[model samples]
Target: MQALRIAATGMDAQQKRVETVSNNIANMSTTAYDTRRAEFADLHYQQLRAPGAISSSTGLIAPAGIELGLGVRTSAISVNHTQGSLRQTGGDLDLAIEGRGWFEVTLPSGDPAYTRDGAFKKTGEGLIVNSEGYPLAGDITIPQDARSITINANGEVYAYFDGETEGQQVGALQTTIFVNEKGLEAMGGNMFRETQASGAPIPGEPGLDGRGAIRQGFLEESSVDVVAQIADLIEAQRGYELNSKVISAADQMLGSTTQLR
Candidate 1:
């Protein structure tokens, strides 16, 4: 009976691992997506005999204790915050961070949200916003008469008018960095919110003071690797099969005991 329960836990853990791997594979094309991994810890051990105890018949101390692990449990599903590759989109609004930072956006509820997906668009009112229509924190707006828009590596926005040769400065962009970027909570819509574990958001200009530079006309790709995920999936499948075999063996032994009567 104990073996049955222990094997069941293993199956459960493997099932979760499969799910996590599948999710990562599914988001391989998602912009600025981070891959997550399932971490497990072994359950408490059942100590049948204590080490150094005198043997009943031999009167000799035991060298090692008899311990059996109960099972395994998922401890955490941590996300990898490593930077993804930059992709050229050829769109004026598309942006990518070359180092470390997230774009600040104002959610509908007036809350601040952070995102690495810089596929921005201009609203009807000329306000710069992400695909979800959330406006950027700096509220950068383009003029109607502007012929073209230019964003530099330092997060400066400029608008060029038709008649004049010189470009006018519209607004500046800013990026937010977290003390623990992995600790931020994913809020869907390719956005994240600050948590206690993530610490407070540190606002900084792009390409300055350790902040990432903004690359215009580009976007960051997803961090998931399909080849690696497939390998992990195969490993998890084998683990699940082994655990099932353990349960089957335990059941067969139990059946033999019943036939002894």
Candidate 2:
């Protein structure tokens, strides 16, 4: 019965692992997506014999203890913060971070959200916004009459007007960094919100004070590795199968004992 329970827990854990791998595989093409890893911890143990106990007959101390582990449980799911490769889209509004930073955007509720996806778009009102129509935090707006827009690697935005050789400065973008990037909560839609674990957001100009430089006309790809995820899926499947076999074996043993009685 104990073995059956333990095997059941194993199966549950492997099922969770499979789910994690499947999610990573599903989001392989998502822009600025980071893979997540499942972490597990062994359950409490049942102590059979206490260590360093004085032996009753031999008058000697026992050096080792006997303990049986209950099972395992999921501890945490950690996000992989590894940088993804940048792909050039040639779109004027497309942007990407070359190193470590996030673009701040103002949500519809006026709350600030951070994102690594730089695929920005201009609204009909000339307001710069992300794919979800959330305006960029700095309120950077493009002039309707601008001939061309230029964004430098240093996060400087310039708009060139008609018959004007020189481009006029429009707005400077800022990058936000967190002390614990992994602690940030994923809000879906390629956005993240700061949490107590993530610490406060540190805003600064791109390419300064350890912030990543802005790359216009580019987008960051997902960090998921297809091959590795597939491998993990297979491993989890095997683990689930092994646990099922253990349960079957335990059931058969219990049946035999009952038959004997």
Candidate 3:
């Protein structure tokens, strides 16, 4: 009976691992997506005999103890914050970060959110917003009559008008960094919200003080590796099958015991 319970926990843990790997593989094409990994910890152990206990017959002390582990449990599902590959889109509004930092956007509820997805678009009112229509922080606006827009590595936005031979500064963009970026909570729509674990957001200009430089006309791709995920999937499947076999063996043994009349 104990073996049955222990093996059941293993099956549950492997099921969760499979789900996490599947999600990562599914998002391989998602822009700025980070893969998540399932972490597990061994359950508590039942100590049948204490270490260094004196043996009755030989009066000798034992060096090792008899302990049985309960099972495994999922500890945490952490996201990998590694940088993804950048692809050029040739669009004026598309942007990507070359290193660390994220773009700040205001949600519809007026809450501040951060995102690495830089596939932004200019609204009808000339306000820079993400694909979800969430406006970027600092209220950057482009002039409607501007012939062309230029964003530099420093995140400075400039617009060239017809009569003006020189480009005029429209607005500046800022990047936000966190003390513990992996601690941020991932909200849907390629956004993340600050949590107590993530600490406060550190605002700064791009390409300064460890902040990543802005790359216009480019977007960051998802960091998931398909081959690795497939390997993990196969491993999890094997683990699940082994645990199931253990349960089956335990059941047969129990059946034999009941058959003894």
lDDT of each structure? 0.94, 0.93, 0.95
Per-prediction TM-score to the true structure, in the order listed? 0.95, 0.97, 0.96
Candidate 2's C-alpha runs over 4 A off are none
Superposed model 1: Cα runs more than 4 Å off: 51-61
For each candidate in turn, give its C-alpha RMSD to the true structure in angstroms: 1.6, 1.1, 1.3
Model 3 per-residue lDDT tens digits across residues 1-261: 899999999999999999999999989999999999999999999988888888568899888988899999999999999889999999988999999999999998999999999999989889999999999999999999999999999999999999888899999999999999989999989999999999999999999999999999999999999999999999999999999999999999999999999
Q: Report, for all candidates in order, the number of backbone clashes.
A: 0, 0, 0
Model 2 lDDT, residue 17, Cα: 96
lDDT of 2 by residue, 1-261 (tens): 899999999999999999999999999999999999999999999888778877578788888888898999999889998889999999889999999999999988889999998999999888999989999988999999998899999999999999999999999999999999999999999999999999999999999999889999999999999999999999999999999999999999999999994
Model 3 misplaced stretches (Cα beyond 4 Å): 57-59
* Clash total of candidate 1: 0
Tens digits of lDDT, candidate 1, 116-200: 9999999888999999999999889999888899899999999999888878999999998988988999889899999999999
TM-score, candidate number 1: 0.95
